[model samples]
Target: MSEDYQLVGSGLTVCEHDAPVEGPVVWLDSPSAVLEFVAAGDVSEKIVLARGGTTTFLTPALTAGVKGVMTLQGAPESHLGILSREYGIPCLMSVAFERGVKSSRGETIPPDGAILRLDVSTHPEGRVFIANGNGHLDVAEPAEVDAEAAAQAEQLRALMASYRGELPKGSAGDRQIRARLRTGVVSTSDENVRRDLAGGEVSDYLSYAGWNLWDLIAARQTEGESGLIPRQEYETVAFVQQWSTYARWYARIVEAIGVDGVIELGSLPRREIGTKVNHVHVWATLCPLFGRAIATELGLEDASARPEDLDALIQFGRRLQHGLWGGGPGFVASRGYAAPVLEASWLERFRDEERRLDDPDELSAFRRFNATTELCGFLLHYDCRAGLCDTGPYPLPDGGFLLVRDHFLHEPGYEWASVIDDLPHCVTEAMFFRPDEDVSIAINDIATTFAQPANYLKHLSGAVVYARDRWDTPVSEVRRLDEAEMARIAHRCDEAMLGLYQRIGDQSVDERIADGVKVYTRDMMMPYARAAGVWDEMVAAGFDELSDLARDAYPALTGGAAQQVLGAVFLMGQGLVPAEGLPPAPEVGPEALPVLHEIAIKGSCPDVDGDAEALEAAGLVVATAAGLMLTEAGHARHDELLAAQRESVDLGRLAAAYERFLAVNGPMKSLSARAGSAGEDERFDLVGQAAELVERVEPALRRTADVLPRFAGYLPRLQEAIRRVEEDDWSYLTSPSVDSVHTVWMECHEDYLQTLGRSREAEGSY
Candidate 1:
């Protein structure tokens, strides 16, 4: 057939199959468009185009209904890519149009009602052709789920539905814990919130924490506090019900997957889970010994001045009598599920009737983990810091541990949390370092040291865990530390903490720390403070150290101000930051174009007064209450520079780099997703994967940087993030607020796309 058609555009095909599909392009650029399209019904011939890969949530209802999907952004690693693959839909990502008429949606497209054909026979690249023929293609029916898989799914769902446990009561302690969890939730972006929504049962972990805390709080009180007490009581019952639900779900998974699955699941990662469980467990196991210690410390033995507080404290011992056995949150959150499940033949080896503190193994492991565990007192802002003092029977070369008994709550800290001191020399050495000889740091949330020292010696400087490696190391070994040995270990811990801040000098460290702090403040603390009704008080207190932290987070702006400037610039780039009653933008010429480029990249031309003035004079930037933000003209100018920059790039070489990048991209993303729910040991392994990924992608990044020097910044940034992970600052792995490994990796990916003059939509990444 001599078909008369034009090759107008092409994209990366999501699926590797041969199927040609034809449909009219329907741009779903907004939520209303999605709603309207879904309402239209029977959209079997409409191929929907969206700007982002994450638009899957919006299009889930439309996915089965549509003929095909063509996204402007996102790669095969994207959620939409995964969904389309699952549905066996013909999807193309990052389509680039060579020539086309502008549509009402502001993107180039073929004429209205024009039929476009997607030829996806090729492995990677899919071709687009405009052919003169009636648009008729048979819609493929949805695939049927396998009978066994369907039954398994049903079984899981049934377990989820059968929970009817009692809820725990609420207290001031519960409120404190909730505040921290809420901060984490509120600090995240809207995009992440949507991801959590898509995550289904996994997101319910937060709910379990909330309800369980309330129960604990209520249990602490001697008598109910009327309205508050009743509410706590109801919430406690609901909490127990949720706990029951989670327990059933976990137990069923264990039963189906067996002991192997249980080992993979490991312990829960949340600090709060361990803290809450340890509190109840320790009180239950050694209340007489610990209760007397606490009474003496709080001076409550005589019960003179604070008899009510003492009585309430004593009530906790009785209220939380159920020892930290198999029914706590840890059971539901962990792999073993509950004690009953442990009795199964496959898991019988894991069962321990001597699981309480009296058992040496249980006691040792508990101290190793919970020594630094802390909590805010009943209603106080400062930490109660009531956890065990230190973790070790850590043996020295002379067969003694360099243990410090005092400050146990904070002494051993994160540095020794996961250290397996008693492992065989060879096994411990293998666990301490990666195969390539990089020191393998353990996963501990409390360790916040970021970046490695520039002139550094590599060694196992912090806690290290072998989560996957099965080992039995008795905690009963008693060791003594000479003064010299004790001092040596203490020095090592100090060195571990000292990194970029000291090595690179305060300015760069200050700025870098500020960047992380800025993200933490804006995304997490501010939202939390506001939610907790303490924002005003914080502001009144002059932001204290927060002001110092935020001030240097971003690159310094011109006019001697940088407060909220990055946020302002980000908003302006998006065409909004909640502006009102602005003055009209001024007109300018090519004279200010260079200055515009500088301001665009550096955020501000602080050193050059003329450059700053040129940008403002060109109406490219506007001053606001926060700081200087880019104007519409500024964004247009920046885009122009970007286009010009792309013209000089070696497209072939950059494309090669992108292909290489794609090789490691999916693995990194998958690792990150898994790390979200994985235990500390598993996360440590994931970090090892991340380090390997960084090495693998370095050459690709170098090739791109050779073409565009600006691209060079990514490698070091990524390395620094991974290095932070090595030092036990786990947030550097994926935290959006900071220049984390994932963040830098993605930025580098986008830079490559931009340099090659490709739209993220066409590339299928957003």
Candidate 2:
């Protein structure tokens, strides 16, 4: 009979079911549809069966007095399911009624207004009874009821209720006890401590503390209010709270497992064990306890989510690029392009050999020089730009590239000199194999971290339980695997290592190339040259002819000031300059101005008694001209550079909108989730937080729209959503409706992707 029914969720009932609840069924496809239906004055008790997976839509429905909820599809432990269990709403997921139920005319089964009965008394899988016609019923069994499991489910429900805030509400005595536990001062008497530990009160306190710790961490990340505790001070407080709480949890564990359990774990000294285990026993016991506590606190639920995995990937990639590709031709080319002096020499060498390549030795020298020169030129021409490219700190062919080039050039007898002949192939090979090898090494490092038998056992135990909880694996069949099986699993996990590397590398390279073109374009360069009145000078004198003179003239404009001048010219071209032109005798920002003024006064206008305005104008012109000729060769290579800059600016603004959304809405969403189990006062406090965060959304959206016109429509919709929430209709925060905050946010997000000419599949959903 149970096999005949589609089981969605199995657990204890959240609320009492003295009798079956029969109600009219309302089938809605989305949160907006539900909102529309409810707002239309349909107040009758009904069971809502939504088509989508998100459970947040139920907030409004529940407020409107829903009898029950059943989703056609959703994970049993999804956020929606968690909310249902917390709200004590009779809920079922993965109903599959679309496939299972059909009418005589072949329509989908359980149409709106169809009467259905849900019986939660059965426990675990509740029974669903449908009234077909003339009072006849079609019964579906969920699962066989388990009494103990039902009891545990009830306890979990109670526990969730208690997690609303710091102190759980109850009789006066219970409140006092909770307060004492929270303060970490549970009666100094040894007998009282022992009794509480034995009675499971210690476990309860630890659970509360753990939840509070997570809440504090979340608050720290999202906190923005001024005059509140400084971030460092808050961190110190959190650290102390964690230490004290974990100590209590560890003490409870020791008490439960007994002295023999501690000794068997080999944490205690044998001599100290007879009387009182000294501080060593406690410290040793705390080590593993601390590890577990930290892991739990950090939410280490997935291997991919672990920081160690990311760190390992970065470390390996860095080593591969620096170790293998370092000092290669590509590296040399990148560096030579950045340094004008080096670039002039490198290009001259390449052109010289090009004319004499008929000889074998000349061909070889030209090949080596050309590869390095091209690589350096490529990086500079395509990857270095103001406000667009992210060319890290060092100029290209970075230190490693330079090292390789130096070795080959200076140490002709070096063994790697032979490798320099085929530098391009060497760099390409390194790029291809780096990620795969790095991933393998990273996985092995992780495996080694669990080399200790106890740690390995813990990891295996966690893996089994995770499988059971998430995948519903039968516990009896989930015994620890042999070494061969474990190795196979590891091998399977690494199957996509190369693909992952390629995907990341390709994305990074594509972005840099796009940025390089946009920032280093002739159109963009024209504005600077025109502003400096160097366009005609550069064209007549020739960039190569003027490069040395410009360098010699602005000898002081090296390091950061050189970069700043380039950036200032780019910004000026983008219309970031003041309307009145140069400010007084001193421009506060962009250090390049003072040096430019000095050079202009000295070289361009050395006569006229140093007239401040004339000198400033002359300095501006000279600076602009100097910037134009500085990287003149790079601009000649690509025509699409200016267009790329525009596209990059658009994408950048869109990205900023998303980042702001996360920063502002992330905390609000967290608070909303907690509000479900919160008491009235706490819920109100959560609402206040949502209001504050929502107020900032409109301005941010407006700012985003100002930068990119395509995003303008989102501002009004977002503003309206915030208005609704602030006006006391709080459901708009997560409402599935079109007017809800989440819906509007997603719409803006979708628009961003569309405008960027990127596909949803390519970007991937959150």
Candidate 3:
């Protein structure tokens, strides 16, 4: 039997031991195959070797009766390896398995029902032997196996003993933090909360859900035992030290700045605003520690900090830290919860595909683009430092970035290469800045140009009114606000809004445009840009477009009409009654009269044919302005128009159109992927297909815009991307740098979820 066997494949061991296990070889090709084999009771006492890389669906089989797992593809940090380590399952990845092999004597080797022996103790390379007989004697003795397990258990005991005694030392605040961790509030059950902790050994609590510190240490000692390398072990140690140091700094800053001061600094009413500002405060406090982390990661030495450049260093460092921790799995998971309708709908499709074995394309595609995967990929590409800041330095569960360029290189379609290349590079360079740059002065200058009182007022009033209107029950119950008090708050918001318009006249269109770009880019869009790896380029392009539009459309916005229209549009989008209210007459001077008339005729403004006093008496008009102000009657008319427009929208039709759009859009991957190293003609052909799909969905999107005008911007943006694609500017095809096709599609989907008042978690299939 031994003579009949032949050599097959070799790979690195995931769980190291001197013992060997022999079992019948079971070859599985896909997730469904694994499931089928388990259901059929064929997995018992078998060595399961599967094709393809790590997938979430394979988890069930891995946990079943299989003796071990050998995969054609998987990395040390891949989901398979992670699970294997967690479950104490012996595994090998990147295995080369031979089928229908013949021996040197031209005899069939290891025929059907072959017994496979997997010996993993050999360092660097493991061995796989196959024998023709069902029983092979290469398996380790039972006593030896038991002894090896006992040794591992003893090692773990010693490691845990050491870890438990090493209490963190720090100031009072730091002690308080450590006390909280010891009290169990920061344990595995509270992984969500612990994930948000800025810096601390508290992060280790994530591993408590599965493996412990003992496992980590033992794995490190055994080298390849835990599917991690020596460098990874060193980094893990560094991470713990860095986190503790930063935690101390964070504690000191909180003590110095006071919790109230930090809260006050993040005055915005939004929950995310408070959270992000708190993160910023932490970064600011621990600037030096973060600088060192950046320097260490970038292979830089400790340099002298110039007083003049300190602020810039701090700002750049803050941005870097934010990029690292912000917009990670926790953030994206929160988005999933908030937008449950979208999440549920997308996931339903994914599940449907998962159920079908005959067609795995959709399942594979969905897995690649699912929200969690996308978020992880985003972190890898943008937040983690790897591959020109375009490719993902895939994040590990332990707050470390895993360099996984080789994994992408071997990915099935090679589309990820194009995806990586398309990402912007320079934006992440902020994290690696030298000590002398005057980044602070530039940041301050930009902030000054962008700070507009009107924009702030707009956001504040919008938030206040939106809360009061949409959350009336909760607000009234919580605040015990009577109608009179609620009315007072509303009036105050209106007054503030009125003040904003009055100040709008102080700045010219050019100035407003510049300031708007700064505010929108830095304050509103920067977070998204950082996560998407398109910060500088996207902001510049978006602002450039805004500037061009303002210049070209100057005539239509004269005589303070721009501000009025803007306020109207803003309020309407928020689902709040326009404060300026629609007016019936010429509120503009002679030069702008034609523009105002044109607007009214276009049904963009209300037309007043009756007496103003009668309209007010009827409660149709409350107060008249030099500009449009809607009385009760005018407000009703406006609502009627909106209602009519909304009535035109068929949700079912729109949903189907969207589904069709995704079906066509999903396969295109990226512009370069479609081009496929082919000639320009092939690229143009692919572009035409995408453009045609865009055209197909235009009518549905237009109808959607009628109901929710916020969606109106998406159609134009999609058209622009298509136009750019047609002009051979392929970057716009799927580029996140600007209003690319994919970006606009995603925004449109978000609008649909919002307008329909649907949660991503609960929504039905599209």
Candidate 4:
């Protein structure tokens, strides 16, 4: 058995003590794989292998269900590694394969289902071993179940089993109806779709139900009539459904910001504001409204605060309502949740027109992400349930219910008119509260009305199809679980989602909710900061800097400060609100060119002698109190010089040098960004990162210097900056106004790109 095993790969261990874990390997290389994972049952014993280092690939529920993780690239500081640590899972990254086999998806890995062992008893280095002939690892252990949580698990299972309601007829037949309905909404005329949808009977019933529930809540009523759910129970279910929706909204927003914001850079950090601000619009307005209502209803203290302290929080509502919306109805189409339900063709035509007008490339910085038009927030429920999709069961006026088995049919709370899938966990967590406790029991206690058949097959089906249609999933490769199997997996997935909710002790539930708000802020904003390349500064300021900003402004949604809102409007009117746009380049005399370039790259320079006077005469450099600085004109002139330099340099040699520079730049950028926030251990690691980066970047610097000798100045400048950084003057690492390591590094990068005739916007590597 021992002879049957062979070492296949090795990587840096994320958490050394958590190594030596063994499980069958399963690769998640595509969206289809993720959907398949959602459909599969008993994945608790499977070790997941992926290529990217981002946590967005796996949903939090899916991550909780897996055994361990391994990646082809990324370090312990990567997002996936951070999540693994939070979950107490073993992770290894940046694996170097000794021998490799390619899978159908074009990823190289151990054969799927092969038992593998990850041993990292050696601390930093971890090894991967695959079973050869025996196909087994002797030390593999079954996952242990916690005794304390088992009782709650049993209660949940029992509750699910108690459902006595009628299920949708014929699983395959139901799926076809749903597929057609979804297709109709996206492609056909809305009139025909609406006619097929029983002339808005579904929406009518949903509205009537919602109104009845609202009225009951207003009356403080809890009793129910025969064959109907109690008003109080409905309220609890509604709260859980809404709570889960908010949580999922937060997660999805983070995913969009973290993943989409950096797509142009391929895992490198860059500041992309379009996605961030767009999401902030929803968070600041509609999300806070719901949060405030929830807090008030629960008698919990409102977490609202003033928003002016956070740079990102200012003027989001004004931007969303006026600036983005001014582009047209299409720009705000996703948020038009209350608009009367239109026919499918009308919606499609509207979408087409919007696409034509909002040429994403030509849009202003605030409108750059015109592609993020997917309906989100409470809008999703309204559009799917009350609008064209009409995912609700209705009385046909003749006989049996017209159960439109569309995208949300099997979702637990959808028939009750909800869209979020994390409701099981939400309900389980909320069960610790009063009305919620009664609501949880009332939901399944009757079996046939609310959240009955508590399965998510249709929800998963719609999600897979959504991915296929919107995200370009390969249609032929898609897979679906059968009804029974889906039901089983749904139960398990819900249990997995309930992990955090299950660990409650005697602590106050209100405090738990508050703590949840804090966690949500840190988790959501950290990724945004990282994607924006401000994680280090934010962390160094005390993660509290970002956290407090999030805590202060987020729950309040602009913090409810009148002055902040008014100031944003004023800034917008003056064309100063979105302040990062670039100005046109300026032309200058050859004599003034280098001086302007020096000031531009170094942030400022000593006026010394008559250089500043000459540049000032040329309307370029300005003599500031600090020193010689580039005016707007000077900066533009420097840009002109940057563009013209390509004609005088060896382009081929410069490109090659830049490629080498990139190999080291990512680690260097990450280290410099983290300098302010590193702990003692992390400080030591950063030192190693700095040394390693210096050694690796040397050849690239030397090659570039061969092409442009002026570039020779960068190496020693970087060395001096690093030397200063070592002496505890940390500002030498990234401060822009000096020959700091990052400053000199970016100067070299800018010069290299300019000499190669490349645009930073086009390359998106900044």
State model 4's lDDT. 0.42
Off by over 4 Å in 2: 1-16, 42-44, 96-108, 134-766
Using lDDT, rank the candidates from best to worst.
4, 1, 3, 2
Deviation of model 2 at 374, angstroms: 58
Q: Per-residue lDDT tens digits of candidate 2, residues 421-476?
A: 22211110000011111111100100011011111111110111001111112323
Where does model 1 exceed 4 Å of error?
Answer: 1-4, 133-266, 269-766
Per-candidate local distance difference test: 0.40, 0.35, 0.36, 0.42
Q: Give model 3 RMSD, 1 decimal.
A: 31.7
Per-residue alpha-carbon lDDT of candidate 4 for residues 96-155, written as tens digits (9 for 90 to 100): 666556656444577788888888656578899887863333332333688877985564
Best by lDDT: 4
The superposed Cα distance between candidate 2 and the true structure at residue 683, in angstroms, equals 68
Worst 10 residues of 3 by lDDT: 441-450
Off by over 4 Å in 3: 1-78, 81-157, 160-162, 166-177, 180-766
Please write out the lDDT profile of model 3 over residues 1-766, one tens digit for every residue. 2566645657767655468867776665543455566667656587776553353334335535367777655544354554454344567766655444433333222333577888876655677777654443332222335778799667545533332222111121122222233233222121332233332232222212112222122222221221111122222222223322333333333354443332333221122211122222222232233223223332232323222233332223333323334322211111211111111232232223222213344332222222122222222221111111111222223332211010111111112223333221211100011112211110010011111111111111000101112111232222222324434432332233222222332445444334333322232223323333444554355423423222333343433343333222221211111123221222222233222222222233344433443333223333322434553334445445444544566667656655554454455445436554757667777787778777877776776555545456667878889898788787776665556776666556645554344565685423
Model 3 score (lDDT):
0.36
Return the TM-score for each candidate structure: 0.24, 0.20, 0.24, 0.26
